[model samples]
Each structure stands twice: as C-alpha cells, then as structure tokens.
Target: MTTMQLEIQAIAAVVAAACALPGVFLVLRRTAMLSDAISHTVLLGIVLAYFWVQDLASPALILGAAATGLLTVWLVELLVGTRLVKEDAAIGLVFPVLFSVAVILISRYARGVHLDVDAVLLGELAFAPFERLTLLGLDLPTALWVMGGILLLNLVVIGLFFKELKLATFDAGLAAALGFAPALVHYGLMALVSVTAVGAFDAVGSILVVALMITPAATAYLLTDDLRAMLGWSVGIGVASAISGYWLARALDGNIAGAMASMTGIFFVVGLLFAPERGLVAVAQRRMRQRWEFAQTLLAVHLLQHEGLPENRVESRVDHLVEHIRWQPVYAEQVIRYAERKGVVRRREGRLYLTDDGRRLAEQMVARA
Candidate 1:
C-alpha cells in the first residue's frame, strides 16, 4: 500500500476505536443522541477556539471543544431536570442554538479563513498525508499521531475506570450507593468524548465519526451480552470496516471516511441477520426444530396417555398409534423412535412402559401446557 493509504488506515483504525469506546456506554445509557448533539455543537467550540487561537492546530482547540461538549451536556441536564422541556426537546434545542452560533461566527468573521461547513462537519482526510510531522527526518501524517495518542489515552482511561464506568452505566443508583461517584465518572467520560470527537473531527468529520463510533458497537451488542466480548468485537468490527472501506473507496474512487462509515453500517446489517443463538436465521432454525420436537413429544404423550397400561401400549404399538392418533404410520414410527431414545418409552416382554423421568415430564407438560 502507498504511504497515504497506510496512514489513512491507521487514522481510521484509531478513530473508529475511539468512537466505539464512548459508543458502548452511550448506547447502554440511552444517551446515543448525545453523541449526535455533541458532534453538531462542536462547531461552536471550533469556531470559538479558532477566533481566539487564530489557528486550528493548538491545544486550545481540544480544550475548547471538550468544554463545549460539557456545556451541551450541562444544558441538556438542566432542561431535563426542569421538566419544562422534554428530552427530545432539550436535544433539539441544544444543537440548533450552538450550531447557529457557530454558523454566525464563521459567516461574520471567518468567511475568508476557509473554515467552511465542509471542514467543520466533514474533514478532508485526502490532505491528511500532506499535513505531516517530521520525527528525526522521518515524516509522519499529523492525523495518524493525533489519533494514535487519542487511542492510547482512551485505553488508559478506560482500563483504569472500567469498573466505575460499567457500574455507572448499568446501575447509577447502585453505583452511587456503593460510594462511587457515578456523576464524576459520567462527566469525565463526557469530557473524554469531546476530546476524542475534536481529534476525530479534524480527521474523518462528524458524520463518519459518529457512524464509526456507534454502528460497530451497536452491531456487537446484537451478538453478545457480555461486555468484554462486546468491547472486543466492537473494536474488531471497527477495524475490519476501516480496512474494507479503504479498499472499496480505492476501487470506486470515493471518500474514505464516508466509505468506512458505510462499511460499518453494512456490518450491522450482516450481524443482525447471521449472529448465532439470537440472530434471525439461527432463531428461526431453533424454533423450527423446537416445534417439530414439541409436536412429536406431544404425540408420544397422547398415545401413552390413552394406553395407560404398559403392556397394552407396547403390544398395540404400531397399530394402536395409527388407530388412536390420526398420525401417519411413518410419523408414528418417528415419534416412537424419538421416545425410545429419550427414555420416554421402553420395550419389555413386547410391551412399552413409560420410564420414571418420562412419566413425570409428560405429566407436567399435560398439566401446565
């Protein structure tokens, strides 16, 4: 692969992982729209920071962006707590006000500065390679380093606070009762999300950033109930989507970030259809098998219920089933075979008798079902 393509892959990989991290908690807390809200309001932070720093590449940018995210969360919380504004209304109010302010700022002052909607909402990863850093005369794309740093920071923070995060997400009241400050953990995560968003925004833009973060995690959720497995699978899905999207974009000459997000979306569809145990196909097959077994078991029980005596039932077996139960001969034989295997019936002196386990189970089924 060319250096640019490699750098794009690396950048996407890191960005996708970061998006997935916050995405897990966001999805669980039912605050997924918060990411969307934060993504839009980030424009205000970028504009405000740019107005002060006069440059996009500065520490103030991330700090300002994180502050804006916190402000968005604060506003949402305040409105929600008031009961005057509904949840959706708070979300609706936060994004428009902040985004409008951002637009007004750019229109008023930065029109000639090239900080347009495209740069704010959808970043230019094509030019990422050209924007590089030299380490010992070996040049590296700025985005790759920025995203790698963000990934490492997220890893450390997540690792250190995994228990608290899980507790805060699953049971906030219990978490608080346990002397852990769920609020503090939540605020810290919000700040981390904002910082990750700002970093990713500069590389992949808002739409792809949110897509990469949420889709993989959402897809993984369908496959596993275990958090550790979900986290692992989510990250794996993100990386795979990044790689596949890169190749697809290459073949079609398309936008890399957009393609990556599309790939993640597709991954979700595939998982929904094919995941085992809970997946559509698997569940259907299991239900079909279960229904067949249930029908056969019911037939055996019906025959045994009619026979009552073991000797009469076994002696009259093949003819008795066909006569009493309207089941075809072949179906009767199939049920007989199954019952014998299940220890539900046994042949003794050319007679069939229900075993202890079989009698108890059949009795319970008849009584309740």
Candidate 2:
C-alpha cells in the first residue's frame, strides 16, 4: 500500500476499534446518539486547547477536549433527567451552541487559524497522513498512537468490567444494588467517549469518526445477540469496510471520508438486505421459496401416492392438487413451472415422473428440514 493508504487504514483501524468498544454498550444503553453529540461538541475543547496552550500537540489540549466531551455528556444528562428535556431535544439545543461558540472563537481571536470549520465538521482523511507526526522517531501519524492507546486501554478496561457493564447497562438498579458503582461506570464511559472522539478527530474528522463508531456496531447488533460476537463482527465489518472504502475512493478519485462512510453504509445495507432471517430480500425470497418448495413437496407426495394420476389431470387440477396445502393455483402453477425448470418433474405421456436429481434434492430437503 502507498503511505497515504497505510496511514488512512491505520487511522481507520484505531477509530474503528475505539468506536466499536463503547458502541456495543452505547447501543444497549440506548445512548447510541450520544456519540454524535460528543463528536460535534469536541470542537469547543479543540478550540480552547489551541488558545490556551497554543500548541496542538500539548497533552493539555487532549485533556481539555476530553473534559469538554464529559461536560457535554453532563450537560445533556442535566437537561434530560433534571429538566425533563428529551435527549434529542437537549442535544439539539446544546452542541450547536457550543460548536457555534468554538467557531466564533476561532474566527475572531485565532484569525488566520488553519482550523477550518469545514474540517471540524466534515474532516479531511486525505491530509491525515501528511502530518507525519511521530513519537521516538517512529514514522506515523500521532493520531494512530493516541487512538490506539485509547483503544487498547478501553478494551482492557471494558473486558475487565464486561459483566459489570452488562448489568449496569441492562439493569442499572440491579447493578447498583449488587454494589457496582453504576454512577462511576457511567462517568467513566462518557470520559472514554470524549477521549475517543478527540483522538479520532484529526484522522477521520468528526462525522466520519462518529459514523465509524456507531454504524458497524449497530449493523452487527441487527445480526447477532451476543455482545462479544457483536463487538467482534462489528470490528471485522468496520475494518473490511475501511479497506474496501479506501480502495473505492482511490478508484473513483473521490473523498476518502465520504467513501469510508459510504462503505460503512453499504455494509449496513447489505446486512439489511441479505442477512439470513432479518434481511428484506432474504426474508422475501425465503418465504417465496418455502411456499414454492412446499407446493412442490406436496405435489410430489400426491403424485407418488396416486401413481395413475394423469399429467393433464395434475396440471389442470392444480386447485384440487393444492387444496390439501391451500395453495393458490397461480402460485402453485408458477412453483410447478419453477420445479419443472429445475428438472425436478417432467410432464410427458400424460404422466409426471421425478428426475433423479430432483428426487435426490427433494429427499435431501425433506431429511434436512
């Protein structure tokens, strides 16, 4: 891979892992949208960090940004729990105001600042590699180490506290009664979310980072009930989508961030349309096929039982043929036609006989089902 592709993939990997960690719990907690709020409001921390330390690489900036992320969570909680504001409403009222202030600060005070609002909102994955920031002479974007450390730390912490998080998320009252510090866990979660958002910002920008954090986990949730499987599958899908989307963007000469988000969406779309039980097309086709096969099975059973039934009698008398199965004649005929195409049944010499492949397939289906 080119350095640019490697850098983008590395950055995406970090962001994907970090997002997947809290995302599993976030979805379970019904706080999936909170990540969206944190992504937008981190600008306040970023702008303040820039102003206070005047150095982008300062630890103070990262801490400041994380602090602001936590503050945003606290503010939302205060609005929702204390003042009865719906969370979506509170989020709508809060982050935009904070973001507007950050924009104003950058525009007025840090006039000639390279911190563009466009980058703050949309982000630039393309330029993330050229920054070439490193620690101890290892050539890599600083974003990688920052997000990687956060990902590793969160993975360990969450793994240690996995049962606690499940209890706290599913039944906070029970968790509290069991001596789990639900409050402390909640606070820790929001803090980690803040840190994650801030760290991923430089590489993925804000929205794409948010997209990476939520979409894959959410998609996995639709396909799996186990938390561990969900997290693993989510990370797998995310990494695949990241790599695929990077190449797609390179192919089309398109925006990398947009391409990545599009790729994530594509995965979700595939999950929704092709998944075994829940996918739309899969469900429809399954029903269609089940009805078709049931009709074929019943027809075979009836013909086998009534070996002397004429083909004309069988074909023209689909209604009688399907009455036991209650199949619509049109549907029955169509299914029969489909079966015929499969070489399962032949209508010749005014009689029907099952082909060898058809009988074997039918026997296998009956045995399997």
lDDT for each of the candidates?
0.82, 0.79
Tens digits of per-residue lDDT for model 2, 198-308: 877776778887778888888888888888898898888878777788789889998877788898899999999887677889789999888777777766655554445
- Which candidate's TM-score is highest? 1
Candidate 1 clashes: the total is 1
Clashes of each: 1, 0
Query: Candidate 2 — which residues are off by over 4 angstroms?
Result: 133-137, 285-369
